[model samples]
Target: MEQAFAQNLMQAAQAVEQQVDDELNRLEKLTESDIEKMRNQRLETMKQEHKKRQEWLANEKLTESDIEKMRNQRLETMKQEHKKRQEWLANGHGEYEDLPSEKELFDITKKSERIVCHFYRESTMRCKIVDKHLEALARKHIEAKFVKLSVDRAPFITERLNIKTLPTIALLIDNIVKDKIIGFTDLGNHDDFSTDVLEWRLGVGGVIDYKGDLSSPPDNNERKKKITVFGKKPKTIRNGMGGDDDDDDNDAED
Candidate 1:
């Protein structure tokens, strides 16, 4: 009876030990699964953090203050250029620098302190008479500038100024059209005309301050007066002839 009891006790002990080993194996598998899950969660969190950092870097750029500063710089540069242009104009560059082209004419008439423009046609005979007077007046009146604008060359300026006559004189003061003199209609119909008559007429129009005698006789060039040099050789006109052929010129004059 004792031997049978001892064998049965041994078998019971072995079965208990097997049960303990099986329980241990089950706990080990559960612990390993929990560790793997925790590792995957940590890796996903790291990926999200990396993505957020990259987004923050990408959004970095010029701030509002930087953009505003750039705008201010541009405005300052424009102001400086404007000041320089005004200074250039103030230095009397507009007084002497005549308009070189049709494009410059408008700017000159609008910007110059005082401007006198003679609009004339090339083939017109009256244009020469106007040019002669303008040349002499320009030399005498240094306060005003004289400019010649060809009517044929500048059709746009002619139309813009509303010039109808072949020889038109337009005066501008402070870049504004003050007055205009058209044709020789003011000089009267007499064939013999004087520059004093022209000058005085312009004076009447407030163009010049010349108080010279208006009724005085005109010069020889203006009146084309015949100077009777009795029995004398005529002086040679050095106009590209380069020859002092007094005999031929005297005979021609006779």
Candidate 2:
């Protein structure tokens, strides 16, 4: 399934590139007057679209037939959204991928415009928790690439990117690191933080393109409570894991 998705995106990208090349070749042959005419045509098209939108929303003066037509348009819009989502899935945007090789990370960053990489250690409990939320986010936000890299396997990248902490979510755009979220500090200091908390954090970093409100906290009432007896008391946690020195050392060894 993933192979098929990737192939579809490659085909689409190639088609777009061909179109761009053709347009550039045509532009080279066109005069300045031709460019101005094309610009005027684009402006007129935008004006028509804007007028249609106004009519779609103007309920006061709309006749029954107009309302019925608008309702059908709304249904068509919903279908279009579904089709767009399918296209997104086909473009390899709907799953949290655990990259097989560290080299593949570089490939993903180059091909994908926006990427969220969770640099995690296998033994760390917090990293596992982060994986759960990230998996959910990958399905929800189909606008960015979500992936994970094992700190042990990706030694060169881990050192170069300065990913010293467990569960470090590195946000990258155009292969350049834009932001990093180390530990659960930004997320309320707890093991059971909701998916939206992580989603909101990613949204803040511009990794995910979303329009939903991120201001409100997830209504996890037990955020202040400890999940297990071994877990630390609910308090502010810094870079280090909330567990003992042995646990921190274990994560560092990765």
Candidate 3:
């Protein structure tokens, strides 16, 4: 009986030691799994932090090219505005004026980019007609200063210009005479001419493109009709006379 009891006690002790060993193994496994999960979470957080920083940098950064393009665009805008202001100030800095003094005429030429001056006589009907056209043009082309000085009032300028004609329209650029709108023929007869005739004459000054249609009499249409000039095809824009190439040597000969 003593020997049987001693064997049973030894078996019980062995079983207890095995149970403790199994528990220790389970605890080791759990600790390892927990440590792996923590490491993975830390790695994921690092990746997320890196991605967020990259996005912030992209949104906030401006490249050299971007800065240069913005600067150029603003500079161009400022240049255009400055050019326009200079022109406006050159044009009496206001609306068209019947220049009160001859000095004002000289000042206008000195200041403006373009000059369209009408040498008018109060009693002359043709001068009156030209005045109306000039007034309308002044409002349209602000880049050019339009002046109306009475020939009787501004005798020195009239004599200097040698403007003997009753109504003379002069277009000057950079203080030099470019073209003179000569007779009443290009403009209709007597006081009947319209603003369009003046616009047509000023086309050479780069103000407008004359479409060869004048506000003249209905009979003038015959001059503008589809004509074969120089035995060639007609074009889109025309000489003031006709839509065809009127100035072509062959057409002029015809």
Which candidate leads in lDDT? 2
Model 2 gets an lDDT of 0.74
What are the candidates' C-alpha RMSDs? 32.4, 26.3, 23.2
Could you give me the TM-score of model 2 versus the true structure? Answer: 0.54
Each model's lDDT: 0.60, 0.74, 0.63
Per-residue alpha-carbon lDDT of candidate 3 for residues 85-121, written as tens digits (9 for 90 to 100): 7768745643668878677877776677677777677
lDDT, candidate 1, 137-184, per-residue tens: 666655556778776677776655656765767666555555565666
Counted clashes in each candidate structure: 0, 0, 0
Worst 10 residues of 2 by lDDT: 237-246
For candidate 3, what is the TM-score? 0.52
Question: Which regions of candidate 1 deviate over 4 angstroms?
Answer: 1-100, 190-192, 212-254
Off by over 4 Å in 2: 1-87, 219-254
Pairs with steric clashes in candidate 1 = none
> Where's the lowest-lDDT run of ten residues in candidate 3?
245-254
TM-scores of all predicted structures: 0.43, 0.54, 0.52
